[model samples]
Target: MNNIVVKEDVNLPALPNTVLPAISELTAALGIPRDALASHEEIEYAWRDLPRELREIPSELRGELIARMCVAVSVGLFDGAMNYIWNAAILQLRQKIRNFSLAVVAQIQQNDFEEKHLRDLQDSRLLGLCLKLNIIDEDGFFFLDQCREVRNNFSAAHPTMGTVNDREFTTFLNRCVRYALADSSSPKGVEISAFISAIKGARFIDNQRQIWVQRLTSTHDAQRQLLVNMAHAVYCDSATAEPARLNAIDLCNGLSTAFTSSIKADLINTHCEYIAKGLEEKHTASLQFFERLGLLGLLDESEQHVIFSRAINRLWDVHNGMNNFHNEPPFAERLLELSHQGAVPETIQDSFVQTIVCCRIGNGYGVSNAAVCYYDELIKGFSPREVTDLILAAKDRTSNLGRRIAGVGSCKRNFKTVLNLIDTASVPNLVRADYDNFVR
Candidate 1:
C-alpha cells in the first residue's frame, strides 16, 4: 500500500522563499489580490497530508496519472491534482466493468453494449451501470457519485465554482481510493447469454452441474437471485424441452441452500403472479418447483392444503391398487418429504392422519413393508391436533379404520403398533382417556 517510492540519498527540492513574494507582486501589478492563489501555509498543510492519504491506495494503482497527481499537489495546484486522481479512479471503474464482460452487460440491458458505449458513458451513468452489475455496492455508489460531482464542479475538469482547500482535497482523494481504486474483491458478473444457453441446452452431467453451481454461488447475490427467477420461469414454460426443464430444476436444487431472503421473496411474488393471472399450467409447474426445492412451507396455508391433499389422495389410491406393496413406497416417501418441509395444514390434518393410520394398519393380507418406515415417521411427527384426529378415527365404528380395528386379528395388533408410535404427551386432554383405553 506504499504510495510514493523514492530512492535513498536523493535530495528533494523545497519551494523557494522568494516564490510567494514574486506571485504577490505579479498579482498586484495585474490589479488582482494575491488571495486568488492558495497561501504558502495552506499548501504546506495540504502537502503534509499527501503521504498519509496516498498510502491508502494500492501500490499497483500508483500509475502515471497518480504520479502526475503527486506532482500537481507538490506544486500547490490542488484543482489539477483532483482532476488526475478522478481520472485514475474513472479508468479503474471502467476496467472493472470491462472485466465483468461487456457482452454480459449487453445481455442484461437487452441492447448492444460495446467498448465505445462504455468509454462514451457519462460519469453519472457509468456509476449507475456499475451499481446495476454489482461491480460497486450501494454505499460505494453514493460516495463515488459525490466524488464525481466534486470533479465536475470544483476540479480542473470543468470551470470552477470554487477552489478546494487542503482538507477538501484530501477528503475527495480518500473517497476515490476507498470506494473504487482500492476495492479489489467486488462480486464478478455472470454472462447471462452463456448461463441461459447452458440451462436450455442438453441435460447436464454431474461435473457440469457442479461447475454451474459453483459459478452461481460465486456470483453476486443480485445475479444469483435473478437466475433463480429465470430458472422457475424456464421450469414452468410448457414449450421448454424435457432435458432443459430437468436442467433448470437441477440448478435450483443445487443452489436452494444459498437462497437469500430477497431470492425467497422474488419466488413467492412470482408464484402469486401465476395464480392471480390464471396461468394454470405455469401454476402447476410452480408448485412442483417449490416442492422440489423443499420450499412448500413458503406457500400459503390454502396452497399447502392443496399440495398435501393431492399427495394424500395419490398415496391412498396407490395403497388400494393391485401390487400395492410395490407401488406405495415412492408416493409414501414423497409425502414424507413434503411433511418434513412444514406442518400439515389444519384443513387437511384429518385426511392426512386417517390415510397414514389406515395405510399403516394395512388390509387382511398385511402392510406394504417398503412403506412402513415412511408411515411410521409420519405418525411419530403428528401434532396434538392430528393426534386427536387419530384417536377419533379409532373410535368411529362406521369408519373403515374402526371397523378393521374392531375385528379380532392382525388389524387389531397393527392398530396397537400405531398407538405405540404416538408420544403419550401428544394426546390431547379430550382424547387422553380414549387413547389410554385404546392402548390397553
Candidate 2:
C-alpha cells in the first residue's frame, strides 16, 4: 500500500552511526526482506535522506511506514519515542528488551520516579521491554489483564454493542485508564485486532489505520501474509500465563464477580470486517489455546464459570468481538468440529444457551439481551435457504421449559439461524477475500 515513513523531530533518542549500520548488517546475515544492514556510509544516507522523505509523505503511506517501523523497532533496528508511534503489543518475541530499556533510559535521560505521567510511560516501555525478552512479568501482565477486563465492562456503559469506528480506539483506552483506576472487580479485558492495529498505526497520521486498511484491501499486490497474521492474532488470548489453575481461577473469580456490570461499543463496519477475517481464521491452536490453558490448571473455577458465562452470555460478543461474521466458510466448519468433539468445554454452556436464546426467539439467556452477533456470524456462513432449515432445527430442539442445548445439532442449527436472520450490512464481506499474512 505504499506505506509512507514518518520522521519525528521530537527530542527523542537517535541511534549512533554504529547502531544504524548494524541494522543492515544483521538483516544481511538473516536475509530479512527489504533489509540491508546500514554501513557507516549507508547510515549517513538513510538518517539524512530518509528523515526528509518521512516528513513530507502523504497519509496513505504513513500506515505502511508505521507498520514497518514497528517491525524495525522490535528487531532492534529503530529505537524509542520517535516523532511517530505505533500500536503497542504484549506479544513477547524479542530477547534483549531489558537490555534495550537500559539503553533507552540512558539515551532519553528520562527521570521521574513520582510523576504519574512519566511513570505510566516508563511502565509501558518496560512492559514492551519485558515482552522483547519474553520475560513475562506475571504481576505486570495480570495488571494489564485487570485493566482490560475492568474496561470491557464499560461496554455496557456504551449505547451500543462492539465498538464504533467513531472515536477510533481513544474510547477504549480512556475507559481502560478509568477502569484501572476505579478498581472494578471485572477481570482485565482482552484486545481485539483493533487494539493492536491502533497501537501499530496511532501516530503520524490523522486518519490513522483506516486509510491503511483500505489500501491493503484494495491492492492486488498486498502481502497476503499480513492479512492472514492479522486474522490469526485477532481473538488470540491477551492473557499472561498463570502458574496453575489457582492463578487462573483467581483471575476468573476476580473478573466473574462483576458480570452484570457493563455496556457495549457501537459496531462499525471496518472493525467488524477485520474481526471477521481474524475469527474466521482463528486456528485450532487459538481455541485450544484457551482450553489447554483452562485444563492446565492455569484457569480457575471462577474463571471457568466466567468463561462459560461469557460463552453463554456473550456468544454474540464472541462472534462479533472476533469478527466472525466476515469470517470464511472454514470458520463455520471449525465451529462444527469444536462442537462435535467432547473437548468443547462444559464451561461454555451458559454462553451457548445464551446464543440459542438470541437466535431462536430473539429473547432471554438470563443476559437480558442475547449477544446477537455470535448468532449472526455462525448463521452467516450459510445461505438463506440453508438458514431457514437451521431455524426449524433450532425451534424443534428448544426445551419444554425453553433452554437451548449446546450440541452439534444446536450449534449447526443456531449457526444456520444466525445467518438467516443477518441483514446484508451485517456481513462484512460480500465475496470474501483471503486474509493476508504478515511477518508477525
Candidate 3:
C-alpha cells in the first residue's frame, strides 16, 4: 500500500456550524444531558485554534496521525485530538531512539537494551530515558513530562477525569510540537564506555583526535561537561599509561573553550579534594592540568603565589648551580610563560622581581646567554610595584643584586642594562629617584 503524504500548504477545514448543535441534540435524544458534550462556543474556539497551531509542525511530520487529530478536532472531540497528537509525539521520540543506535544506549545504560526493552517502556519511563541519553534537554523533559500528565488525565486514550478547554488543548498541541516533534535533529548521546575505552587505549592520531573532538562538540553540553571531568580524572590517575594521559589531556584541551563556570568549579573542587586528602601526586598533576589548559588564573591568589614561588625558587637554585648557563633557559622560559598567564600575586612580587634581576645580572662568570632574552622580556613587562621592588633590591646591601651593584664591573653594567629595559613611565613616583640614580 502506498502511504499518503500531507503537504504544509494543506489547510485544515473548520468545523461546520451544524456539528456542535447536532452533537447536543444527539446527546439529548440518548437521554444524556447536553452539558455532557462541548458547548458551541467551546467548539468554535478550539476549531479556530487548530489551523494556527498545526502550522507550527513541519510538513513531513503532518502524517496520518496529524490528519486524525484534525478530524477529531473538527468534531469537537478535544480529548481525542489531544490523544492523537500525544501519540505522534511519542512515536517521534521512539524513532529518535532507534536512530541514535540501541548499541550506544546499551553501552551508556551499562545494560543490555534490546528492542523489547525499548518497546516495553511506559511513556513516563521513555521520557526519562530520552533525558538520560540527552535526546531531550532539561526544558524539553520538563514541558513534555507535563504534557504526559495532561494526556493521562484529560486525553481520550484513557477514561477522562476532567475536560480540557480550548486554551488548554491548544497549549497541549503547542508544547508537543514545539518540544518534541519540531526538533528532529536532536544530538545523539555520547557512548560513555566507548569514549573511556578510546581514551584508555593507544594514543589518538590527529584525524582520530579530531573525530572525537567533533563528536564531543556535537553532543549536548551536559555530556560534554561530564566527559571533561572524566578526562581530568583519567589524566590524574597514577596508574594510567602515558598514552592514555596524553589522550585525556588532548580531549580536555579540545573542549576547554566550552567550559562553563560550573565545570570550572567542579574541577577546582576536585583539585581541592586531592589537596585535602594530601594526595601530592594527584595534586601536582591537577596543577599541571590547570597550567596546560591556561586556566591558572581561575585559581585563588594564595594558590598562584605558591605556584610562582616554587617556580621562582627552582629557577634561582638552577641559576646558582654548576653549569648554570646550560640549565637556565628552560626554567626561565617556563617562568615567563607562567607570568604571562596572570598578574604576579602580591605576596610573591618581591621574590619574583629579585630573581629576574639577579638572573639578568650574571655572576662572576657572566649571565646565561640563552636565558637573557627571557629575563629581558620579563623585566620589560614588570608592573610599577615590581619596578619598585627591583630598585629596592639594588639598595638592600644584603641581597645579591645590592652587593653586585655596589661595585663597578659587568655585573653593575648588566644591572644598568636591566634598568634600561624597564619602561620609564611605569616607574612609581616614590621610586623615581632610586630608578634615576640606578640608571645614571
In TM-score terms, which candidate is top? 1
Tens digit per residue, CA lDDT, model 1, 1-440: 85664422323256567765776787889999777877667777777777766776767777899889877877667899999999999999999888877887787788999999999999999999898877888999999999999999999999999999888998998888888887544556778778889999988999999999988887767789999899999999999998999999999999999899999999999999999999999999999999989999899999999899999999999989999999999999999999999999999999999899889999888999999999999999999999999889889998778888887478889999999998999999999999999888
Q: lDDT tens digits, residues 12-43, model 2?
A: 24655466555666677787843332234433
For candidate 3, the clash count comes to: 0
User: What's the distance in Å from true for residue 278, model 2?
Assistant: 34
Off by over 4 Å in 2: 1-305, 314-354, 357-360, 363-374, 381-440
lDDT measured at residue 220 in model 2 versus the true structure, 0 to 100: 19
Poorest lDDT segment (10 consecutive residues) of candidate 1: 4-13
Q: What's the TM-score of each model vs. the native?
A: 0.85, 0.20, 0.83
Off by over 4 Å in 3: 1-10, 14-35, 39-41, 101-112, 300-303, 317-330, 360-377, 408-432
Q: Which stretches of model 1 miss by more than 4 angstroms?
A: 1-56, 185-187
Local distance difference test scores for all models: 0.88, 0.35, 0.87
Question: After aligning candidate 1 to the native by TM-score, how far in Å is the CA of 80 from where it should be?
Answer: 2.7
lDDT of 1 at 47: 73
